[model samples]
Target chain A: MAGGYVGKILKVDLTTKNVSTEPIDEGVAKKYLGGKGYAVYLLYQYIKEYELKGLSPKDIDPLGPENVLIFATGPGTGVPRFPSPGRYHVMALKAPLTGSIGSGNAGGKWGTSLKNSGFDGIVLEGVSDTPVYLAIVDGKAEIRDAGDLWGRNIFDTTRVLTSVVGGKNTSVTCIGPAGENLVPMAVIMNDEHRAAGRAGLGAIMGSKKLKAIVVSGDQKVSVANPEEFKDVADRCLDALKKNPVTGEGLPTYGTAVLVNIINNVGALPYKNWQTGVNPDAESISGETLSEKYLIRKNMCWACTIGCGRVTNVKSGPFQILASEGPEYESIWALGSSTGVKDLDAVVKANHYCDELGLDTISSGSTIAAAMELNEKGYIPEEDLQGLDLKFGNASAMVEAVWRTAYKVGFGKYLALGSKKLCESYGHAELSMSVKGLEMPAYDPRAVKGIGLNYATSNRGGCHVTGYTIAPEVAGIPEKLDPLATEGKALWVKIFQDFTSTVNSTINCLFDTFALGAKDYGELLSAVTGWDISEDEILKIGERIYNLERVIINRLGFDGKDDTLPTRLLKEPMPEGPAKGQVADLEKMKEEYYKLRGWVNGIPTPGKLRELEIEV
Target chain B: MVMPIVNVSAKILLFATLRDKYGVRELEVKCDGTVRNLLENAAKTLNKGFLARIYDISRNKVREDIIFTINGRNIKDIKGEIGIKDGDRVAIFPPLAGG
Candidate 1:
C-alpha cells in the first residue's frame, strides 16, 4: 500500500466463524483515501453482490448473519503528520434511529492499537452465539468472554475492561447499559470520552450481542517517504498547533465556548428553536463553568489543540459530583433546548449521557421537543408523570436525561428521537431536525451556511461536516451578514466535499478547520507519497458523498427527500439581528444539487464515471 | 502623527490538559500593527489561533479553558496587549484549572 497506511484488512466471519486477511492495495488507497473511503468501497462491493442476487431471501434480512459492520482506520491514523486522527468509523446496516447507513466516529488510541495489532480494518459478520469482546494484541485476535462486563455502563465497563486488559496502553471502544438494553438512541464509547454517538449503532451492536473491543499494540502506522513526510507533516502539524482555534480557543474552553457567542448572536436554539436565545445561557457558559467548576482541559491523541473540558461541580445540587462537560451542542440541546441553563444541571446531564452511552445532542433535542409539546397543551402533564417539564427547569432537565437513559416515565417517547417523538404527538412540524437527527447550536435564520450543512448532511442534521460560519460569523476568513445567504451554496459545497475527504482519511475534522484543502493535501501527499492534488482529494470527497447518498437512495432517500423541518422553513427568528430571517434552503439545495452534478436527485452517470465509481 | 506598523506576534504553549488542542504545541503570527490592528486586518476568516496567531484557544476568545498571561500576570489581569511586539510570545495557552 501507499504512504500513511497499515496495509491490511481483517475480515471476521461470525456465521462460519472464520477470520480472513485482505491486503490494502495502493491503487485504491491512492484514490479513495482511507477509513470512510474503504468503508464505502467495501459497502459498495457488498451491495453489488446483493444486487446481482436480486433481492433473494437472504438479502432482505439486513439484521441477519449476512450483514456486516466495518470498524475502519485510515491512512493518516496514528501517523505523526496531524495531531487529530480520531476519525475511525463504524459503518453498516440501516440504524434503528434513521435507518440510513450508520456511520459514526469516535477518537482514542483504539484505532492506533488496531493498526499496531496488524490490521488496517475489522469487518465483523454473522452473529456469534456467545457474547464476546475482541481483543487484538499485535495481529492476534481472541474472542474473549465478556460475561461479567456485559451489563455495565460505559464508565464501569471501561474500568472493568481496563482491569481485564491490565494497562493504560489498552484503548477500549464499547457499548454501555443503554446499548445493551437496545435503546434506539444508544451510543458507543471510546477512550472513556470520545464516542460514536449517533444513530443508535450501539443498539445494532447490542442486537449482535457484542460488548467491547479492546486493542493494544506497538505497530507504527507507516508513511510513504519518511523525510518528506516528516518535513511537510511537521510543518502542517506545527501550523495547526500554532492555529488559534486548534491551539488555544478549543483547548481552553472546549466546544462550550459557543454558549456565549451563539447565545450573544441569538443563534443558540432556545426552548426547541421556539426562541432564538436562551435567557439563562450564561449559567452554562464557558465563563461561568470556568469560574465555578473547570478542573482542566484535555485533547485526543496527536491533537495539539485540546478542546475537551474537564470540570468538577463538587457541591452542586445536581447528582454529578464532577465531570468534563456539557459541551456546546449538549449545552444548547440539554441546557437551553430544555430551558435549563444551570451549569450544574448541564454537568449532570452530560455525565449521565456518558454513563448511559447516549448522544447528548439527540437526547437533549428529544427532551426539548417533549417539553414543547407538554407546554403547548398537547401531552398531558400526567404523561410527564408529575414532573413539571418546563423550559429552564434544571432539576427536571437532569431527571429527563436519566429517565430517557433508563427509559422511565416520559422517556420512552423521547428514546424515539425528535422526529418520531413529535410525530407521535401529531406536531411533527415542531421538531427542528432534518431526517431524524436534531439540529446543533447554529440557527439557520442567523447562520445560513450552518443551516445548509445540517439540512444536506448525509447523517441528517450535522455541523461537523461544514463549519463555514466560522468565517461567516466568527470573522475567521471574512465577515458576512449572519442573516444573509449570499454565495452560501457554493461555500457549503466546498466545505462538504473537503470535509468528506478529511473524515474518510480517518483524521480529525478539526485539523482541517484551520486550513483549506490545499494545505491538508500537502500533508497527505507528503505522508502518502501519492500524487494527490487538491482537486483529486476534493473529488474523493465527492465520491464518498455520492456513495453515502447512493446508500441512502438504496435505502430509499432522494432529492424529494432532501427536506428541512416545516418550522425552520416557515418560522422567523423571534429575536436578535435576524428577527425576520429564515434559511433559503430551496436555493441552497438546488445549487448544491447542481454542484454535485446529480440529475434531479439521482447521481448522474457522467459524474460517477468522472470519479471512477462504477455502479 | 504617524501610526506604528509594528510586527505583532504571539505563540501558545500547552500545559496540563490544554496540550491536546494544538496539533503541535506552538504557533507564530505576523500581525500588522496595534492590538486593534490585526483584529481589524488579519485573516479573521481563519480560525482564531490562525488569525490571531498567539490568541489563546479560549472559547469566545474570552472563555475559561484558555488564557494568555503576561509578565507573570494573566492577560485578563492586565492590558492584554492591543497588539504584540515582534518576538513576543504573548504566552497564550490553556489555563490552570485542574487540581
Candidate 2:
C-alpha cells in the first residue's frame, strides 16, 4: 500500500447487518487516487454487481436499497500539513434530483476523523430494516439504533452523536429533517456546518434508514517519505500563505468577498438570472457582512486559509446568535437570486440551510423559481397558504426554507427542487438548472466557458467542477474575456479534467489560486511514493472524468441532456457590463466534444481504452 | 494647430481588500483620458499606500496583480493605448477568487 492510505475499506451491509473490511487495491489507487475518483470506481463495481443480479443501471432508483453510497478520502486528505487537507468526497450510484451521477465534496474535521478511524472510505450497501447509525472507533465498527435521533435536525443530531461517541478526534456526518423527509435537495452536513451540499445524496443516506456516521480514533496518517513530503508540503504552504487570494482576500472577508467582484463583472446572477446586475448588490456585499455580522473567521481541520465565516445577527427579525456561513454561492442563491437584498435575511436563510441540512444553492434557486412561478400566475394564490411567495420578500424567503425541509404545505412543492417545482407549474425553463441540478452564482450567459462547463458537467450545473470563473472573472494564472467563445473550450476541458484530480486528492479548490498541476504532482509523489509527473496527474483526472461521463451515459443521459437552459442560450443578459450577451453553447460544445474524443457527449471506446478504463 | 486637452471624469470602483483598505467604494477622478492618468489623479486625494499598491513608482506601471477593468472590459483585452472615456466605470481589484 502507498503511504497516506489506511489500506482498508469498511464495508457495511445494513439489510443483513453484516460488517466486514476490504483491502484497498493498489492498482486502483494509482489510477483513481481516491475520494470522488475512487468512490466512483467503487460505485461502478457495485453497479456491475447489481447488473449480475438483473438490475440495469437505468433501473436503479436513487432512493432504493441498491444505491451504493460511499464516503471517501484521498492520499492528500488528513495528511498532516497538506494544504487544506480537510476535504472529502461522497458519491452515490444515482442522485435523486439529477438522475445523473451523484457526487458532492465538503470540508471539515469529519473527513480527518474518518481517516484516523483506520479506513480510507466506507461503503454502504442495502437498506436497514429500521433507523440506524454507524459507529467506527479505533478500527472497530458497528451499527447502532438511531430511531430516537432520526427526526432531529442536523445540529441536534450532531450534538447527541458527539456526546454518545465521545473520545478524541470524534466527529459526526449526518442528515437532518430535510433528508429524513426524503427531500430531493437535502444536504449531508458534517462538523455542524460544512456540507456535501449538492445532488440530494443525503436522501440516499436517509432512505437507507441511516441517520449519522460517527468516527473516532487517533491514528496518524503516515507518508512514505516524511522528509520529502514535509519539504514539498512546506513549499506549497508558503505559496498559499503568500498568494493574495488564499492568504488575504479569503481570510479577511471569506468567500463572500466575491460579491462585489463578480457583480462588477456583471456575471453575478441576479433575480433568477433575469439580469446580470443587482441594483442593491452592495447592501448584501461581503464588506457589509464583515462589518455588521462577522464574529470571526473559522477554518476546517489543518486549513491555513480560514474562509469560513463565524457570524452573528445580533438583533433583527432574522436574528441568529451564531452561524457559519452564507458563502459566496449561498449569499447569491439566497440573496440576489430570490431578489432579497436584505443581508440579515440571507444570513438567516443560510443558517436554516445548515441546521436543516438543505443545500442552499438548490433551495434558494427553487424559491426563486417559485417566486417567478407565483408572479406569473402559474402558481395559484391559494396554494401559498398566505406565505406571499413574492420576489424580494425576505421574511417569506426565510419561511420557505424550513417549510421545504419539513415538507410542509407549500414547502412540499418547494422541496421538489426547482427542476420539478418549475416543471409541475408548466414552466420548466424557469429552473435555471442543467441535468436537474441548479447552477451556482456565476451567470453562464455572461461567461462563455462556465456556460459550456455547466452544460457538460458530469454533475449538473456545478461551478467548482471547472471553475472557469478563475480565469474568466478573477484573472487567475491568466485572464480571459468572459464573453469570448474562442479558446474557452480548451479552458473548460482542462479545468474540468484538472478539477477531477483535485477532487480525487480532495483538497480545497482554493489551493489552485496559488498552486497548479505541477505543485499537486510534487505533493502526490512525495506522499504516495509514486513518481507522479504533472502530465500523469492530468491523465489520471481525464480518466476519472471520462469514467464519470460513462456512468452517467448508462443512466440514460445523452448529448440531448447536455445543454444550458433555453433562457441562457436564447435570452441575452438585459443589463450590466455583459449587457446583450448570451451563452454561445453549441459553438463551444462542438469543440469540447472533439477535445474529449467524445461523440455527441459520449466518450469513444478508443478514448476509454487510452485512459485504461474498461467499461 | 493643437487640440485642447479636455479632462475626462471616470468612476473608479474598488473591490475586496482594496475596498476595505481604501474605505471607499468608488472615487470620481478627472484625468487626461488614460488609465495611468486616472490612477495618478485619484492618488492625489488617496493615501500613499493606495498608490504604492496599485502602481510602482520605480516602474511607473500598474502592479501585475491588480485587475483593472474599464467599462467592464479588461484592460488586457484592449491592449496598448487603452483610453478611459468620460463617465466610464473603472473597476480595480486585487487578485482574488472563490467559488
Model 1 B-chain TM: 0.49
Q: How well does candidate 2 match the true structure in TM-score terms?
A: 0.98
What's model 1's lDDT at A46? 75
Global lDDT scores for all candidate models: 0.72, 0.91
The candidate scoring highest on lDDT is: 2
Tens digits of per-residue lDDT for model 1 on A1-615? 676787888887765667788888777776677787778788777777777878532234435565667888887788864658755878875666776667787776677767777788888877777677877777777777888888788888887877777633578889887777677678888877778877787777776777888877777777777887777767777777777677766776777766755655667788888867777766777756766888888777766767777877777477555566767787778888888867788888888898888888888888888888888998876678877778878888888877777778887767778888888889988887777777777888777877878877777777876777665555555544566676887788787788778877777776765666777677788777877778888888888888777777777667765777877788888776467777778887888888888765678888888878878
Given candidate 1, what's the lDDT at residue A479? 46
Candidate 1's DockQ = 0.04
Q: Report the C-alpha displacement of residue A209, candidate 2, in angstroms.
A: 1.1
Docking class of 2: medium
Model 2: per-residue Cα lDDT over A1-615, one tens digit each: 899799999999999999999999999999999999999898888777877989899999899988889999999999989999998899998999999988999999998999999899999999998999999999999999999998998999999999999988999999999998999999999999999989898899989989999999998888989999989999999999999899998999898988887888788888888888888889998889999999999999999999999999999699999999889999999999999999999999999999999999999999999998998899987788888988999999999999999999899999999999999988999999999999999888778899999999988999998999999988888989888899999999999999999999979999999999999999999999999999998999999999999999988888998899988889989988788888899989999999999998899999999999987
- Give residue A470's lDDT in candidate 2 (0 to 100): 92
Writing each residue's lDDT as its tens digit, candidate 2 over B1-99 gives 964265789999888788878888888998888766788778887886787889777887778788888877777666568888899999998888888
